[model samples]
Structure formats: C-alpha cells, structure tokens
Target: MKQLVILAGGKGTRLKDRLGDLPKPMIPIAGKPLLQHQIELAGAHGFGEVLLFVHHRADLIQEHFGQGSRFALPIRYITEKEPLGTAGAVLAGFDQLADRFVVMYGDTMMNVDLTRLWSAHEQSGADATLFLHPNNHPLDSDLVETNAEGWVTTFHNRPHAAGQFFRNLVNAGLYVIEKCALEPWSHDRKLMDFGKDLFPALLNRNAKLFGYNSPEFIKDIGTPDRYDWVCAQYEAGIVQRSSLATPQRVVFLDRDGTLVKEVSAQGLHRIEDLELLPGVSAAVHELNQTGLRAVMITNQPVVAKGFCTEEELQQIHNKLETLLGREHAFLDRIYYCPHHPEKGFPGERPELKIECKCRKPEPGMVLEAQRDLNIDLANSWFIGDTTTDVQTARNAGVKSILVRTGHGGADRKHDVAPDFVFESLPEAVQFIAARSTETSGE
Candidate 1:
C-alpha cells in the first residue's frame, strides 16, 4: 500500500491573529478545519496508511483524530518537541514510511490526482517525483528550471533572474519519494526545507528527480487573505471540499438582511426583534434536508461602533438560533466582521477601518468560510439582500442570488444585478431545488 506523510507542525505565525490558539493545519476553511480536509483527501486518493507529523498543538490533532479509522484509513502521529524542517520531518517518520511514499505540506491545499502522480513516478523509474505548476509571480516563490526531459536542471531560491525559465514553473509542494532519497541527508543537519536543501543535494548526486505537471488546484494558506480565498473557492465549487465522503455542496447566505430583516440601523437591541423574513426558515430547512450547509456571513459593525459589545452580538446570535430552532432550521456557521472603518466611536479605531480583505465586498469572509467548511463555490451559491454581498460573491468568483426580502428588493435598482432574483426566500429555494433536480436527472 502507498504511504502518505503530511507535515502538520507549522505554528502558522502569519495567521496567528486570525486563527489564534489553533495550529496552521487546524485553521478552519468553511466549517471544518484544514487538517480535516487533508485527511479526507488522502482517504479519497486510496491511501490505506497515513502519517501526520505534529509539533505545535499536537494534542489538539491527536484528540480530534485519534486513529483516523473514522475516515476509513489508518493514521499515525509523530510529535516533535523541536522545530524540524520539511525533509527532517519526513526523515523523522522514516521508520513508518513505506519503501515508496508521498509527502506533502499540511498547511497547503491542493486538488492533485495522486493516482496519476504515482503512475508518472513509476513510469519514469525515478527516485523522486516533484509536482510543478505554472507561476505568475516567480519572484515571490522559489523558481525551478527544468530540462526538456522534465529533469530539474537548477533550483533557484528567490532568484532575481529574468528569463522564460523564471516564469515557466515553480514547486507545487507535493512530492513522491523513494526510500533511498533520504540516505544522503546527514542526520546531524537541522533547519532544512525540501526545495532548498534536499532536492539540490539529490541533483548534485545525479539522482533521478523528475517533475510531474498536471492540471491541479493548489493554494498555500499561509496568510489570512489566502485562507479566505481558499474557503471561498470551496464554497463556490471552484475546488472540491475534501472532507465529505461523497461530493457535497453548500449555499452560503448573508444573515442580517438575506434571511431576516436588516438589523435596524439604530441597532437590534432586543432578542425579540430578531425576525426571519417570509419563508426564510422554510427555505433554509429545505437546503438542510438536501444535505447542503446553510452558513451565515454578516458584517456586524455594531461592536466596532460601540453600539454593543461582542458579548451582545453573541447573545443576539443565540437568540437567532433559538428562533430558527423553533422552525426546525439551523445555521451551520456564522461569520461576522466586527471591525469598523473609523475610530470616532469610543471603542472603535481608525486602524480597524484601514483596508481589510475580510470585510464584505472583499470576499475575505466567504473565502475563509469556504476553507473551513469545504463548500464548492462554483457549484454553490451566495444569497443576500445587499450589493456588498453580491460584490463579495463576485470578487470571490461565486454565483450570487438576490432575494426580494430585506435589502434585496431594494438592491435590484442598484448598479449591479444578481445572477438570479426571487421575490422571497421560498422562491429562491424552489428555483435552486428545481435546478438541482435537473442536474441530477431526477
């Protein structure tokens, strides 16, 4: 059986503020964490045995997935007390790895066909196979120049060299390695990355390191904005959510105005005022029964405005859940931006207003939600009552629907028009259900 090793030890320092208290791999995309998706993908690719290398938050990972049997694959964990570079982590798990194994970065997500990658490696008869993808911004990444036969000729770490080779290809952070490749790395060496160190050493020894080029979706969620983008792609169906046993889709809704009446501009000070629009609960229930996750993305500037505290917002959301529960409907997840643009208000500050990608119209919330939830945006849809919501979907490259309830009806007269418009939430549900039926040939 093919063995898979995932490097899951990164602290994700770049995303510390946004994903506090969680390891980089545990950061959520839509509703599920990134690590969950990686595991699911391994299972999907038919890997019977898998290994996870953990250092930071090792307990969190172990607690959540003890054996990985639930995912139909056997998983083992190796914890490191000190920092181990990419190659080191793989070497650390050397005993567990099979003669032929696949190694990948845990914090990054990709839709690569492992079967094809493995086939290529076997056909080339190479000691190692490196996955490569076209790079538009080579300067930001380590550039790899390859020969006509797909053998990597030179590896440049952030080189300023200007040429066709620079724009040709870059490492996609996925690799298949034979057990012999690890023999050369000195056991005493520390702080080594595969691209910068191991691959170069292999090249000097004239080892067979072949490159496999395929059409695969790859993204590095090293920063908050990238995290958001990956999530949105999943929601829009641009990329498949790796968590589900079978293909699953979701419709992300903007809460404040799309499902319920817009919180009064003066503010929703009371729980009783939280009211759902006509047919809103029923529409959401329909989606839930159909195996779709109905997530809420709202911008509650109230906390930043000092109209209420974060606690107040949580209480209001609690009230919303109670109200919806009465109708047998539930929200899978709720994401809101509490920061505001100006600091005139006592609790608010100009820094909060400084341009942020997560705010509505920026696609940050939708993207992050997609990463956590694994929603497919191209196959999924976003329904809201405001232009910002529509713009958010557009910026994130997802389909947008506008419901007549709340601010939606008013938005029709604005400059941008939604892909579809409905007089009420039920109408939108009916339309989507019919479309789904048509798609499934039922």
Candidate 2:
C-alpha cells in the first residue's frame, strides 16, 4: 500500500493572528480542523495509512488522531525537532517513504482524484508529477510552462517581469514523487524546498518532470479573504461539482482567421506565410495552462484544390507548431478538412476532391475529436471567425463564440446566432477563463 505524506510542519506565520495557538493544519474549517478534512479525503480515496510530518505543536496532532483507529485511517507521525522545508521533511521520513508516494501540503482543501493522479505518475515514468491548476490570479502567482505531452519545462515564480503576460498554471502544492529521485540530496540534511531548490536542480539535469493540470478545486486558505471564499464555496456545494464529478472543458479553435492572419485571396501554400495574430500565442498558452484542451479545427480545402499537397499542409502545420512552441504554447490536437465539394481548379486532385463530413458547418471534426478525447460538448466552446464555424458549434450542441479578427464582422449576422461575439481570440479566451468556475451539466 502506498503512503500519503502530509507536510503539516509549517509555522503558519501569515495565518498567525486568526489561528493564534493552533497550527495551520489544525485550523478549523467548516467546523472541523483542516487536517481532519484532508485525512477523510485521503481515506475516501483508498489511502488507508497516512504519514504526517509535523513540527509546531506536534503533540496536539498526535493526541488528537491517536492510532487513527476511530476513523479507520491509521496515522503515523515523523516529528521534527527543527523545522525542515517541504522536501527536507520527506528526506527525514526517507526510511518509511514508499517507492512511490503522494506529498501534499496540509494548508489546502483540494478535491482531486488521487487515484487518477497516481495513474498519471505511473504512466508518465517521471521522477515527479506536480499537481497544477489555473488560479484566478496568474500574473501574481507562480506559473509553470509545459509542452503538449504535459512535461514541465520551466518554472516561473511570482514577481515575474514588470509587464509580461503568462499562462495561468500554478502549482497546487501537491506532488507524487519517486523515492529514488531524492538520492542525490538525501545526505544533505539541510533545509530544502521542492520549488526553490529541488525542482530547479532536477530541471538542470533534464529530469522527467510532468504537470497534471486539473480543474478540480484546490485552494489554500492562508489569508482571511481566501478563507471566506473557500467557506462560501463549500456552503454553496460548488466543491462537490469541482471534484471528478464534472467533465473536463475544452476550447475548440479555428486555424486561419482565428489563430493566424488569413492570406489575401490565395491559399496558404508555403510555411513562410503562417503568421500568428497578436495575442494568439498567449491566449492559446493560457488555454494550455487552464487545464482546458486547446484543439484546432480548421477547413483547409487548398489540398483538394491542388494549391498544396498533404505533405505541404503538414509542413504549414509544423511551422505553426514551431511558432507556438517558441512562445511556450501548444495545441492538444489539430483536425483539418482536406476535401472540397466543388473542384474545378486547374490542378485539382480528384482523390481529395470528394465532399467530406469534416468541413466547417458540419460537426464532423468536432464530433470525432469529442469521441477521441472523451469531451463533453455541452461544456465546451468553439471559437471561429466564420458563420460556418458558428453553425458547426450549433450542430455539435456546444456553445460558440464568433471573433471579429478574421471574417467575424461579416459572419456576425449568421442565422445560427453565436452564443457570444468577441473582438479577437484573446478576448474570447479571457471570457472563458473568467467563467471557468461556472457549473456544467453534461
């Protein structure tokens, strides 16, 4: 049986006033200590044994949960005479740490699937898998940049540059790490942190560090305002829906007019012609960070018209991916329609000229992606610049947003009527991020 390690050794300096004599983990939340909530959640997720690393007022915690027989969740403690930072505490418990174990901060009340997180860690074959989520305030929070495969490439702590926009993925203070990954620093016996010290060293060695971006609610009630908000969320039962109970949300985007500047009258036949519009990279990167899958659904009839071959189309996509990668952005998947109904062009290819279901206005690409990604259409949103795009969302039973960047101005009067209209892709993304906490039915 794997162990769940809870770091309950913090002094709670910021919360000292309200929680006078009590440790941060023992602070009451919804009529129970925060540690109790964490224990119950772990037990519910099949974690029968919990290893708590405690320092401040350790005796109080040990006496309260004695042997854990009452709750059926056995408890063990690793008392530290002096304060050990997050990672240091784990080293102290090195003898008992399992081959693979979970590490979570005791200050947070989060509703996540430990089972799924464990599964992700096992499948990734990574040294560590950090729990990442999009916080309301990205600019002021520590951000993480990841590739399309969810590998953590960079870590940007708070107090970033003076005026720089960044993706909103924040470390939620939960992790699944392998015991062998700590061998290098196990003998130090000094204060060390996962973020400030260990993670940076691992990144320098090109370690396999992945990020599990989850939409599940995870909040640290460190300040008074945040505490009140968490209490309100619990009272409203929003916490329950934020669990694995709800489906993941997706943002389906259009390629030409929406993501990049559309070509004049000619089709995109060369990679040099691909230019990402203003803020498109940042917007897509934000989607990547927000735990929302950013998928590209475009209609590329140039292949059937003989303007470009399928290989050339692939080259164009490669250019787009390279551009986005340069800005720390990536698309989860790209789906394009290469067929056209009317083929009278001089160099048209008959094999690729057949009418297909994947073209815009037909929900073929969206439906196929939904089937493959297990997406919930009702909770997803489609953003495009043409009337066909709006109609496609309607056909797929998902919400649609028409942007003014591409052909949006002329397509606004379409009969299908978009759910919302924005001036650009960034505006649409802003709207979606702001409403990320809203409840979804399907």
| Best by the TM-score measure | 2
lDDT by residue (tens digit), candidate 1, 291-365: 466778887777777777666677677556545654767666677887766656665645455557777878889
lDDT accuracy of residue 194 in candidate 1: 92
Return the TM-score for candidate 1, rounded to 2 decimals: 0.55
Candidate 2: pairs in clash: none
- Global lDDT scores for all candidate models: 0.75, 0.82
Candidate 1 all-Cα RMSD: 17.6
- Candidate 2: regions farther than 4 A off: 163-166, 248-375, 379-385, 401-442
lDDT (C-alpha) at residue 245 in model 1: 30
lDDT of prediction 1 = 0.75
